[model samples]
Target: MKQCLHFLHTALFARAEELLAKRIIDGDPLAYFLQGQLYFEEGWYDEALAQFEKIKEMDFQALYQLGVMYYDGLGTKEDPEKGVEYMKIIINSNSPKARHLKYAAAYNLGRSYFEGCGVKHSDKEAERLWIIAADHGNPKASVKAQSTLGMFYSTSNPKDLKKAFFWHSEACGNGSLESQGILGVMYLYGQGIRQNTKAALECLKEAAERGNIYAQGHLVEYYYKRKFYTKAAAFARRIAENDNIDMLAKITDCLPVYIAKGVAMATFYLARCLQLGVGIQQDQAAAKNYYSRVSVSLQVHSVLLLVLPIDWINKFVSICRR
Candidate 1:
């Protein structure tokens, strides 16, 4: 039985199925559960339900799936009330097998309450259930619960910002991309924790690597501000590849005006990338055009400083040349 389960875990589905078939012939309940899971994945919900129902003593996980099927109208009529009842049973169960099931059951029941699905809508009740699930040692439920709590406390009093920070931090540690991005912003601004630019950059970089678009945007700005042109250009090119009209407009507009340091630097880095072909195809003509604009701006700034001492003017010109 353990070998069969190991095979299933390793994705040797054919051998696992054959082993499960033999176990089912021998009336093994665990085999029925495993077979039901396979059928469910295959979208043969009717067969899955049949196998699940044949177990004389259904474990909480199997029961939870039955509840999901009823609620989702898979091989059964939509019956949210019945679904709620089954979920409650798992939550109330004392069996050690109910350990993980309880977390899922609590989360699902919380959603039911929050959405008024077979239950009265009650924000307080929903929050309570989610908290229970969060403390139940399931990473997925913990992420959901922490994210909800973080958002809830974020809009409250200053005192609650700390609470929000704690929840977001917890979720971020659990690999929640949204929480990671939010935590990065929080750290950047010192919202709930001490301002730590290094920490903020690390969090934003991790989130960006995980495909968080908001984090990517922040990282692009961060690298640009620090004059890490190569890094900034790489990120900017990625964003440009996405072809977001609003973002492209923002990037391009920065080139003609000194609206913000980060934006201006990003524009400069992008132009430099075009010039040097660093992480992008080089276009000398386009690069020269951008460089001309920069040179003109510097020349105008030097003219403004002409009223200064001769030494100052010479120093300024030398700086510009460099």
Candidate 2:
């Protein structure tokens, strides 16, 4: 059973998958869960949905999986209302089987509220639900909630920089890659803490090497502002050149939207350098082309949320004002 569970996550093991499927034929509940997981991971959403729906009443994990699939419209039409109800079932369950899943469910529920999915948009309720999930912050699964709380506090109107710093600090310590990169940003800018260039550089450099796009974005800005035009342009060009919408969609599907801000930032800086010919070879036509992509966004549930943070608006405004 353990091997089969591991195989569900490792696509290289076809034999183990066959074994798990065989077990499913015998009505093994655990096999069903593992099978659903395998299908979900492989992007076989419709099959995964069918498997999960069958055992959702008995398996907390299946219920949670169903909630996520329905909410996200994975292999099915969007049904945020049904998704929320499934999550609520897991949250309200008194069964010990639900103990390990409640925190994650709460976090997802908080995101639903925060994003106004199947629920009224309520920062107050979102904050409340997230706090519950964040309290279980020691677990790997809990780290996402911790990191999201930081993002929420940092960007929401009437922002709480202090709390944002605290939550980000907590999430970073809990091993959230996103939070680790954001820590660099906050330290560099003194968002809610004392400015520490040395600490900021260390954090950003380490996170950037680990592929934290947020850190990479800020690193580009850091280089550009310091007149390290060559290094800045080089870094930004790498990200800008790989502008595949499908790839970005896959990334944003799993990561927070703000990560797109990093792509936007990198692209914007690269475009600026090209326009000014301050770094590398300047190409006016190339500069204009890149500028056009900085404000791009992705559509979700009929709303075009700026996954790209198309934050170029802020940058363009800064440029205009100058």
Candidate 3:
């Protein structure tokens, strides 16, 4: 790990990648997985696919990862049908640990079906698969299931409020900050759970402390709603200080959304540099130009989050103003 950090800091990308490949070839499934990730990051789709495929031979999660890539054309041509085929193999396998893969497969299959991405649309089929996936312990699927169930309940279908609450709570407890933040909002507004500001505050605080932007925004909103300016400012300061790049730079993917996030973050730091006249003169015009370019790039990439969090917006605003 220390060697890897040194390589990254020294920007020896090629050597680092070569070393990673060596590790992969040395019979390390994790190394193979990471090599695949590195290739994906470098946009060497074919190479990435090859590495992931090798890992798939021994790792079920690797299989699922490949299935996702294939489905989204991350490192290969978009082939939802083929993706579904691979998922089906995992879903039908009798391996004990394959249950989680099965759930993931089912969820992906349903997503493909629902979006007609690589299959025909079928709401009924999607709902069925979502239920199966949720039952198999897929936290994401569980949240979706609750959402769909909530929609159903609005039409006088027996509203499984308790079940929805349970699933959302479970997903939150399982480390899904989106779930935590959403559940926090629901509790705060009495959408599903009992109206309990205290519970909402606790949930949002947990998510924010863990570096979840969604949770941070919710925390801000919670504080604002309750006129807690001091708390809001303190959390905002935390946001300003957190080393987002340290965490993000560790990810080795060139996904458009992720790339956009990186660009945005980098632009923000550059702005900070200019504001403080660090490593350069304080040229507000140049700083603004950089931010503008990132904004345009982000817009072109369509990474504005089909569902953006408020904290994200706040971050954007703060950086832009600086």
Candidate 4:
């Protein structure tokens, strides 16, 4: 019965694909959108770009896809300026077809302003755009803007912890994995929220179980602080050595900037454990290697020029001195 169902599903999917291809030949914009999304998900960036560009004038969704592809340099030379322009076009639009996409485009535009990718760095502009997106938050798709608002508030000059907490809570409730981990930290630190150790642990554990690398990093710190060196070592070992510099370089699109901090924390904690022989079998030489890598990661990932948390380098200085 299972095999029959699987076969039926496959047959149905193939038929749909055939119809989609036919519609593409017929110049159906929606068909091009569907096919382009399929290609995007499958990592066929060039084909996806081609399909989206074909319907760019007719669909805001296709324009969004084109912006993302150019922004990420998936199928073309990295052109953040062009991507930013595309997003801006969507935001200025009043077409009903663009209503659903305005929030997404605003969020991406905010990021560009924040990072100075195509525009001069402007926290004011970033906040404005993020607010536009966050105001339109929903269970689907708007969580990123919500979570980003939380991050922005947390780091804003004179920091609005209350706003940060509120946004993170909203994002977490809406099923944002990143916000879930951040909520744990806020709870643990009593940052704009009451301290609740039990809630903190539960939130961190749940987020970690769901494969949130950010939560995993903090979990390592939590265990290490509690003297659960074995568990900390086990987790930090995996996180610290998980080398995906390529992804790290281009991580700005969908991930929080704090992700670099998380990776660095895990690496630092792992190095500390190795130096002291606290958990895993330690080699002083290997510890030194990780220690050096921490600094290198702080410098750059070499692809998209992402610097892994240089702000936390002071934490490693004492360890290096020893």
lDDT of 4 by residue, 156-272 (tens): 988999999999988889888888988998898788999999999899899878767777888888899899999998899888875674484354232634565567678888888
Query: Candidates' lDDT values, in order?
Result: 0.68, 0.81, 0.62, 0.82
Point out where model 1 deviates above 4 Å.
1-12, 72-78, 136-141, 155-159, 221-233, 236-322
Candidate 2 per-residue lDDT over residues 1-322, each given as its tens digit: 9999787757565776899989988878799899889889889899999999888888999999999999999989999998999889988999999989988999999989988989999888999999888984665557889989998898788889999999988888877778888899899989899999999999999878766776888899999999999999999988766555446546533253445667667888998999899987889888877776764532221122432335546666566354
Report, for all candidates in order, the number of backbone clashes.
0, 0, 0, 0
Number of the top-ranking candidate, with TM-score as the measure? 2
What is candidate 1's lDDT per residue for 52-140, written digit by digit as tens? 77762666667889888887789888999988898899899888988777777887888788779887888779879878977843466
lDDT by residue for model 3 (1-322), tens: 9998987855876777889878867866577777777777777888888878876867777787788888888867788777877887788899986775676687778777777777788867876776787673445454554444333332224555556666667656655554565567678768666899888878867755655554564565455446554554444434434334335324421123433443454454454445555545677786676567657655775644533446756776777665
Residue 291 CA displacement from its true place in model 2, Å: 3.3
**TM agreement with the true structure for every prediction:** 0.63, 0.83, 0.58, 0.80
Global local distance difference test of model 3: 0.62
Candidate 4 residue spans exceeding 4 A from truth: 1-17, 25-29, 77-81, 245-257, 280-283, 301-315
Error of 4 at 235 (Å): 2.8
